[model samples]
Target: MTQPPPPPPNQPPDPQGGFGAPTPQQPEPGYGYPQQQQQQQQPTEPGYGYPQGAPPVPQPPVPPQQPPYGYPTQPQQPQQPQQYGYPAQPQQPQPYGGYQQPQQPPYGYPTQPQQPPYGYPTQPQQPYGGYQQPALTPSAPGGGKLSAQLQIVIAAVVAVAVIIGVGIWYAGSGGDGKDDEAKGTGGTTQGATGGGGNGAGGIGGGGKEKPPANTQAKMAFQVPQPKVPDVTDVSGSWITDKAYVKPGVNSIVAYDLDKGTPLWTLPLTGQVCGASRHVSADNKVPILFEATKRVAPRYYQQCTEIGLVDLNTGKLVWSTSITGGSAGDQKARFSEVTLSGTTVAAGGTDGGAAFDLANGNPRWKPQVNDENCYDMGYGGGAGLVAVRKCGPYSSQYVLVQNLNPTTGAPVSQYKMPTGVKYASVVSTKPLVVAADVGETAGDGSGISDFFSLDEKTGKLKAKITADADQYAARCRSTRVEACSQALVGNGRLYVPTEEHEGSSGEYGDETNEVIAFDLTTGRTVPEKADAGDKYTLVPLRMDGGNLIAYKAPPYDKGGQIVSIDGGTMKSTVLLENPADKSVRDAETSFSLNGAELAYEGGRFFLSETLVSKAREGDDRNYLIVSFAAGH
Candidate 1:
């Protein structure tokens, strides 16, 4: 899946005209009381009668040096007669109400120069009262009085502004009284729209409610890692060989998943089969093992024997015969065998066949063309057998067939990719089935592919290709093919791949990794180790859906066990083994229901490595994990 895009940058702020506050208008000219009085006097100068720019002329020179007698002195006596005698000539009375008037000279001033009173104008007074306050006329722009029409216009604008402001306030506040009446079912104002309205079903007013608690269920089997044993050839499933144990021999010993456990100093019985054969389908019954009487080149006589002691009573159960080949045949060997329900199905060097649980009756037989159909597994509601067929001419045929456990009928068969056929079945699921795929016959240098097959049909599902042959070279020089890459689990399939050499020139002897693939979906989880990382894999029995994958430390034999809880799709490391000891690489592993049962390092081991919570009592703790169906 593609990744999502990044987010955008933060938005810029919006602009508002100015600061959004009211501005003070320039004060109207001459508006204040004292300032208006000064304005009224400005008009008076305009109405005054004085002529602009008029200059005064000198009158006839008065007789200066006049004596107190009102006559000129004798030194200026020549002009004194005209000046002193002229004043007494006539004190004529003025026509208007004048107290003393100068001689009315017709040529000197106006002939009828009758003046008004001292502070009045020269003209006779009219009937109108004083000045009439100049009728308050409109003035110019400099220092003018307001006209009547302008005053009316200003008043109308103020009224309109007030009306507009009131209308805006009303609209913003939800349309005034009409809205209030329409929404006043409860006779009160509300802050938000439809706020505190009746809720669904009209039960109570709406408001916030709390979230509910988590109530989901989950699966509980989380498998812890298994303890390492002190042995090599640790491959395939574990078995107790209870079907062939002698009466006087030791019993009930614990061992690791790989090797047979030690009872005091005695070796476990029937553990050294020619093909290393062991089979147990029902956990309730004793384990069945194939004990070849002679070596591979000699007489090939085999028997399917049972332990002398029972699991519950410690008593010997009846031994059953597992007939394989003609007494003269030497190449015949028991490859894979398992008990399904009450019937037992065994695959061998010649062909595949079935046996009855009650009396060992021959059910059916089918031939295998593969030369190396050497391994068998039973779990996923069916039984499977891995084969290496040698076909016509020189073809190396490799295949695995699903068989009817009761009748040995070939239900399904799978043919893996060419040149990638020598493999061991690791684990299978509904969607993806996995197996170890590579050239395991001799010293090879090619890549290994982990094949996943569909459980329903025997078709190829997916492939996880890696280099297992290179990894097995360094794991140990004594390792065999069966014990090389043994891996199995429920949700996971473990495929061991070799790690490539780095620039450090440090060949850590053995560098291997267990590749885990999700079986539900045919995908490799991202949690897998980096390519060429080294590790080992040990698959415990399926408990339910959840399983465990144990991870060993890098460059060290000792490691820790990790429980993989399937429902959560996660793994947690649980047990940490001691660092001093090297792990015993065994080939066998088994599970009784959810528990792991094995025998390695000289003891029989049974452990409930991962158990569910639903079955959690001391009495119910033991689970009989079997890879078989009911009778």
Candidate 2:
């Protein structure tokens, strides 16, 4: 689906206007004290009117009077002298004319009515050599006045202590409160969105370290074998820490990836031809296209039905029938189904139809007369794409159209280059990369060319003459397809190449090379080595900044899965296929349907098919093996 435009840049307002400006910093809470009241100034001494007269007489010295209230006064002599080695007690002060005398202590050692020395409060005398109590001011009842610098220091200490305590509590409770809540509600640590703009519910493409090569493979889960007429297709999609699998033609099951327990299952009455998971901002559901036949006495017919079901509950949210006709009418059935945003589309020979995933109501269905329009599949997050042929079998011109994901209408259309009957879409966003397929050369070699198109206007951006013959020769003896698969990632299109071997047909040789083309410049990237002899690595999918690949040597058996550093091209084996015979056979069958490696929540998954032979008969079983990273 067309991705929503990015939010506008957040720009701070101009200082001149003062609009959207940041608020002035306020004093930290609990660190600031109320402004000190201004001290009152004493009235200026009255000017002497007789300044010019004779000097005043000198005054006599007088004994000091009792200090004012709240101020410490000098200590008075004891009432009586004490003997040697014995402490002397000072006499109590007389009550002031207006103020009440301080209360006496109940713990004996009579309260000293006499004021102690300045900066020191009266306290009971300590024993000889004992620890002495520190002197304290008696300016105020609650606390004494402190200097401004001292107050700042005290505030800083208190602020630091509070911060440390909060940090400890946060660490103990979990780093992020939202993440803790998600975990409690069964959310995974891996990113919800998958690579290739595939959407949210699939296996996450974010960086997930693979398991060690020596780690053992264990079955994480398996669905009970369901009896069906035939197993048309088997596929799996990741939903949080669980996997949703269409294990059989008439059954879809969800299993917990870690515990291997079945969560739910929905049995079907017809064969599912196409299935995909729609992942939006708030919801994820499986959309299935099934063809069911009804055998009535006079009417034997089949109809195509599209449905949406909850992933966790297996409840049918909504379903609608698309086409109803004779069972043998091929043109009346939808051959493929895909999801984009809130729209689910199914394409077939006549044309294609779309329905709103939210409510299962028909959105639109474009009609193309006498031409087969097939769904080319999702262009990542760009939108849905389809190819329409103009002429009959003898001669035809291929037309490519970018369909509006919301309305099922063509946004742009362009005629492909002459002589190419089909194009394989590699990406659909900022740039569209496709490989045009043409007839094989007279020398029995394949012919293919890569093209880049502008996503907005469907105009040709660039073209690269692919060396299909060289690639075919390299994989001639291997089970891997000779046709190069184009993978776009990190602003470059990776094109398979056999440049190292050239045109040589050396026996037992394998190809492990890919030429990267800069998307913006349309030039080959020479900084990266196009080939390596250390391992037979075939790029599968992009995992964050790294490229996940499969070691292709042991094609008939379980092989090593490695991750290639995107910048250095260094290969590290992440997982190895089990040495068991059943696993080997299963890997062979699994490889027939492209690569089976998937990463989700720091774990890797490989879906395999196991065949069990028994006295009664042989049964085919499907099992998904999970390999946790660092295990």
**For every model in order, what is the number of clashing pairs?**
50, 0
Model 2 Cα lDDT, one tens digit per residue, 1-631: 2211121122111111100101111221121121221222112211111122333322222222222222223356644432211111111111000011123221111122322121111344333122335545434336778777775676567545543321110000110101110000000111111122222123223456654545444444434344333223344354554554444445566766676576777777665555553355444553544555323342222336777766656677887755311112232455456667777766444345677878888765433332323332333244666544443444444545566677544555445544444444456554443432333222222233445555455544444444433332111100011222455666556544432321223333333464455443233433232333322455666666556765543323345666655544456667665646665544443432222456444455656332122223543344455544335
lDDT of 1 by residue, 1-631 (tens): 0111121111112111110101111221221121111111111110011233333222223232222121122243355433211111111111100111222211111122222211112344322211222323445488886788896676567545543321110000100101010000100011111211111122121211111132111111112222222111112233444321221111232222222222322223343222222233433233334343233343233434433223333333444443332212232234444454565544434434455656556564333222222222232223443332333223343444444455443344455443322344443333232222223323232223344454444544334333333232111111111222334444444433333332233443223333344332223332222212233334333334333434433433334344443333344443433333222111112121222333221222333322223422323222221111111
RMSD in angstroms between candidate 2 and the native structure over all alpha carbons: 34.3
How much is 473 displaced in model 2, in angstroms?
14
**TM-score of structure candidate 1:** 0.40
Query: What lDDT score belongs to each candidate, Candidate 1 first?
Result: 0.30, 0.41
Q: How much is the lDDT of residue 49 in candidate 1?
A: 14
lDDT of 2: 0.41
User: Best by lDDT, which number?
Assistant: 2
Error of 1 at 140 (Å): 68
